[model samples]
Target chain A: MVQLGRRYGTGPSSLAEIALDEDLPRAYLEQLVTSLRDAGLVVSTRGAHGGYELGAPPSEIRMSDVLRALEGPIAPMICATDDPAHLLGCDRSARCTVNVLWVRVRDAISGTLDSMTLADLVPARNITLDPRDPTASPAGVA
Target chain B: MVQLGRRYGTGPSSLAEIALDEDLPRAYLEQLVTSLRDAGLVVSTRGAHGGYELGAPPSEIRMSDVLRALEGPIAPMICATDDPAHLLGCDRSARCTVNVLWVRVRDAISGTLDSMTLADLVPARNITLDPRDPTASPAGVA
Candidate 1:
C-alpha cells in the first residue's frame, strides 16, 4: 500500500517503476497489481503511456481493505473469523475461557483498522515530528 | 497462539485433539508443537498418559513472546523491525510516510497483547453471552 501510495503521489507510475522503487520483483508486482485491480483499488491503462492509478481516492481506501485484499481475513485466531466461523469446536462455547479474550482482541484489531482510512495514513501537507522532552521524568511513562 | 495455547493447556490432549479442537491440520499442529517445545513454551512427556503442558505459568508468559515463537517478528512494516531495520531506505527517516503509522499499529498490538496474560484470558469465572437483541446496534450489542 505504501509503495503504491508513494508511486501514485508523484502521479500514476507503471508497475515496473513501482516494483523497482519498492525493490519488489516486477513479476510479483504484476500479480499484485492484478489483485488490486480486481479489488477496484487500482486501475490499469493499456498502451505506451499506460500505467496504474488509484481507482478511487486514497482517502476512500482503508488499511484493512488493503490488507484483506493482499492477505485473507485479518483473524488472529481462526475461531474469531465469520467467513468460516466456529473454527474451534470447544464443547463449552457459551463459557469457553480463552475464546472471549481472543474475540475481544480480534474485534479491537478489526475496529482499529476499520476506523482508519488511507487518508489518515497519507497527509497532503508537509509532515512534521512532535518534539520529545528529554528532561521529562519517566515516572508516568507506560 | 490460541492453537498452541490449547495444545499446552495443562491437559493430556493429544496433537490430534489440539488440531481438531482448533480446526487445524495434524501435520501443521505437529510442526507448531515442535517449534513451541523447542522455544520452551511447551514440554513433552512420554507414556500412555503423556502429552504437552505449559513450560511456564500463563501469567509469566506474554502474548508477544508466544507470537514471536510461533510466527516471526510482529513488525507490520519491514523497516520497523529489529531483525532488519531501514528496509525501505527512505531519505526522510524522521518523516517516512508509512513506517510511522505501521509502527503505531505494531506498538498498539504488542502493548495490548503484552498487557493481557493467558491467566487474564482464562479466568476461573465462566463467560456468559448476552441474549442478542435484534433491534440493537451491532456495535453496541457484541
Candidate 2:
C-alpha cells in the first residue's frame, strides 16, 4: 500500500500488474488489496482495465498507517500496548519492569514509522549514490 | 520470545503457568518453546515439577538474539535485511531510490533492540520514578 501510494497516488493499477512486478502471488495480492480498500487506504475499480490505487496522497500516508492496516499494532509486547484497559489475565503491570522498556521501544518504533510518509519513499527529485566507494554517498541533483 | 525468555529467565515455568501468565495457548507455547529450545534459547527439564528456563542469563541475551531465535530478521522491507539477502524484489543498492531509507530504518530498530541487554529489563535496584504516580516519568534513567 505504501509503495502504491507513493507510485500512483490517486491513480488506478491492475492487481495482476502489481503482483507480477512485485513477485507476489496474485491471489494474496487480491485479498490484500481488498483489505486496503476496506481500510479506505485505497480504492478499486471492478470493470475491464480497473484495478487498485491509493485513496489519499502520498504525503498523507504514514508507514504506521500501512502497517496497522496489514499487521495490527507494531507492539513487540502485549503488555506494552495502548489498549491496556482490556488486558486479560495479566494484572501484573504494576510490577512489570520490562513493560516500561517495551513501551519505549514501541513508542520509538511507532514514532519512526509514523514520521515517514509515503512521499519520503518517493522523493520529488532524483539522486545519486556511490556504493563501492566507502566514503562516497548519494547526492541529489536536479 | 522475548517475553518468554524473560519469564523463563526468572525460573523454570510450567506450560500452564506460561499460558496463564502470557495469555497464550499451552499447545502454541509448546511449539514456541520447542523452537526456542532447539535454538538453545531455552532448556527443558522433565518430571512433575519440571518445565523450561532460559539457557543463559538475562544479561547475556539481546532482543535480536531472542527475535532470531523465535521469528527471523526484523527488517520491515526484505531488501533492507542483512542476514537474508535480496529478499525484497527491488534492488535499492543498484537502482531503487528509497532503498537507503529502508536500510536506515532497519538499522535504527535493530541497533536499539540489540544494545539493550535483558538485564536492563530486570527491575532497577533504585526506583527512579514514583510507583504511585501513574503519569510519573522516570528521570535521569536510560
Candidate 3:
C-alpha cells in the first residue's frame, strides 16, 4: 500500500516493480492486490503495459478503511469489535465487567487508524512532523 | 487480570473458581498465571484454598506492562516495535517511511493501555470516567 501510495499519479506500476522496490514477494503482492482491488483501495488496469494504482489519492484513503479491507475488523478480543454489527458472543458478557476496557482499546485503535491516511505514510511528500509525535525520532532527521 | 483484580482484597481464588467465573479453561489459566507470576503481575499461593492474586494493587498495574509481559513488545510492523531493544530486522528499513506510522500506532496503543489499570475494569468500585471516552457507551449506563 505504501508503495502504491508513493507511485500514485505517476501511472500504474507492475507488481514485479513494487515487489522489487519493497522487498516483498511478487506472489504475495499478487494475492494482496486482489483484495485491495476488490475493496476499491486499488484499481487495476489490464493490458501489456498496465498494472495497479491507488483507487483514490493517498490523502483520501483512510488507513482504517484499508486495514478493515485487508484484516476484516480491528479487535483486541473476540468480545470487543469496532464494528457494532460483527461483535462475537462472549459468555462473559453478562458478568464481564472488563468488557468496557477491551471496548476502550478497540476504540483507541480505531481512532488512531482513522486519524491517518496513506499520504501520511508515503515518504514522497514533505510531511510536517507533529512535534508531539513520539515516532518522530531524531534518527529520521538528517 | 480482571478476575484477580476483582478478588484483590479477598485473599486468593482457586483456578477452578476463576475458570468458572471467566469461562476459561483451567489449564490455560494455569499456564497464563505462571507467566504473569514471573512478570510480578500475579502471585500464587499453595494449599487447599490456594490460587492467584495480583502482585500489586490493581491501580498500580498498568495494562501496557501487563500486555508487554504477556505478549512481548508491541509493534504494528516488524520494523517498528515499541521497545528499542527488540526491533526486528526489516529489509526495507532504509526506506520504510511507513515505519513511523506503525510507531505512532504503537504509541497510541501504549498510551491507551497505560491510561488504564485493572482497577478501571473492576466494577466493584466506582470509576469516574472521562467525558471524552468514546467507549463509555449508553449501554454501559444502566
Candidate 4:
C-alpha cells in the first residue's frame, strides 16, 4: 500500500513491477491484486501504460480496511468472529468463558489497525539530527 | 486452563473428563496437555487417581503466558516476530514500511492478553445487577 501510495500519481504500476520491488511472488501478487481490485482498494487499467493504482489517496485508506480486504475480518479465534452475527454459530457463545477475552483481543487488534493509515507507513526520507539540540548528535559524531 | 483452574484442589482431573466437559476430542486434549505440561502451566500426577492440575493459581497465570506456551509468540506478521532475531529472516527489515504498524498491533494484542488472567475467564457463579444503575436489569426484569 505504501509503495503504491508513493507512485500513485506517477502512473499505474504493473504487478510485475510491484512484485519485483516488494520481493513478493508475482503469482501471489496477481491473486492479491485481484482481491484488492474486487475490494475497490485498487483499480486496474488495460493496454499500454496500464497497470494498477490505489482507488483513493493513501491517507484515506486505513490499514484496517486493507487488512480486511486482504485477510477478511480480524478474527483471532474461530469463535471470535469479527461480526456479532457470526457468534451465533458457536454453541457456547452464550456462556463461553474466554469469549470476552477473545473479543477484547480482536477489538484491540482491529482498533490499532484502524488507527493507522497508509500514509503512516510511508517511509520518511532524509531524516537529519536536530542541530539546535545539544544531544542530537552521537558522542563519536560532531 | 479454565477447566483445570475450576478443578484445582478438587483432585487432578483426567483428560477424558476434561475433554467430555469441554466437548473437545480426547486425542486433541492429550496433545494439548502435553504442551501445557511441558510449558509448566499444568502438572500431571501418577497412579489410579492421578490426572492433571494447574501448576499455579488462576490469578497468577496470565493469558499471554498460556498463549505463548501453546501457540508460540503472538506475531501479527512474518516480519514482526516477537523475537528480534527472527526479524532477520525478512530482507526488508531495514526499511519495511509496515513493520512498525505490525509491531504496534502485536503489542496491542499482547497487552490485552497479558492484562487478562485465567481468573478473569473463570466462569462467574452469579452475576448481579448494579443496584445503583436502574438500566442494569433486563427490560422485563424488575
Models 1 onward score TM values of 0.57, 0.57, 0.82, 0.84
For model 2, the docking class works out as acceptable
Model 4 lDDT tens row, B1-142: 8888877667799988988888899999988888889999999997888899999988899999899888877898887778666655577776577788988999999999989999899875445566776555422242
Report lDDT (Cα) of residue B20, candidate 1: 71
Per-residue lDDT tens digits of candidate 4, residues A69-126? 8898789887887866655457866656888898899999999988998889876533
lDDT (10s digit) by residue, model 3, range A1-142: 9989878888989998999988889999899889899999999999888999999999999999999888887998888987778888786688878677778888888888999999888775443378666665533366
Q: Write the per-residue lDDT of candidate 1 for residues A1-142, one digit (tens) a residue.
A: 6555645555567878877766678899888878888888888888887888887667788877876777767776776763465466556565466666566666667767777777776635433343564454423345
User: Relative to the unseen true structure, what is the C-alpha lDDT of residue A120 in candidate 4, on a scale of 0 to 100?
Assistant: 90
Give the alpha carbon lDDT tens digit for every residue of B36-134 in model 3.
989999988999989889999989999888888888888777787888888877776787787767777788888888999877877754343786777
Ranking of predictions according to DockQ = 4, 3, 2, 1
10 residues in a row with least lDDT, candidate 2 chain B: B133-142
What 10-residue stretch in candidate 3 chain B is worst by lDDT? B133-142
Ten consecutive residues with minimal summed lDDT in candidate 1 chain B?
A: B133-142
Indicate the DockQ of the complex predicted as candidate 1: 0.29
The share of true interface contacts that also appear in candidate 3 amounts to 0.77
- In order, candidate lDDTs are 0.67, 0.70, 0.84, 0.83
Clashing pairs in 4: none
User: How well does each candidate reproduce the native contacts, as fnat?
Assistant: 0.35, 0.45, 0.77, 0.97
Q: Of the candidates shown, which would achieve the greatest DockQ relative to the real structure?
A: 4
lDDT of 1: 0.67
User: Which ranges in model 1 have alpha carbons more than 4 Å from their true place?
Assistant: A1-12, A82-97, A119-142, B1-60, B69-73, B76-78, B82-97, B123-142
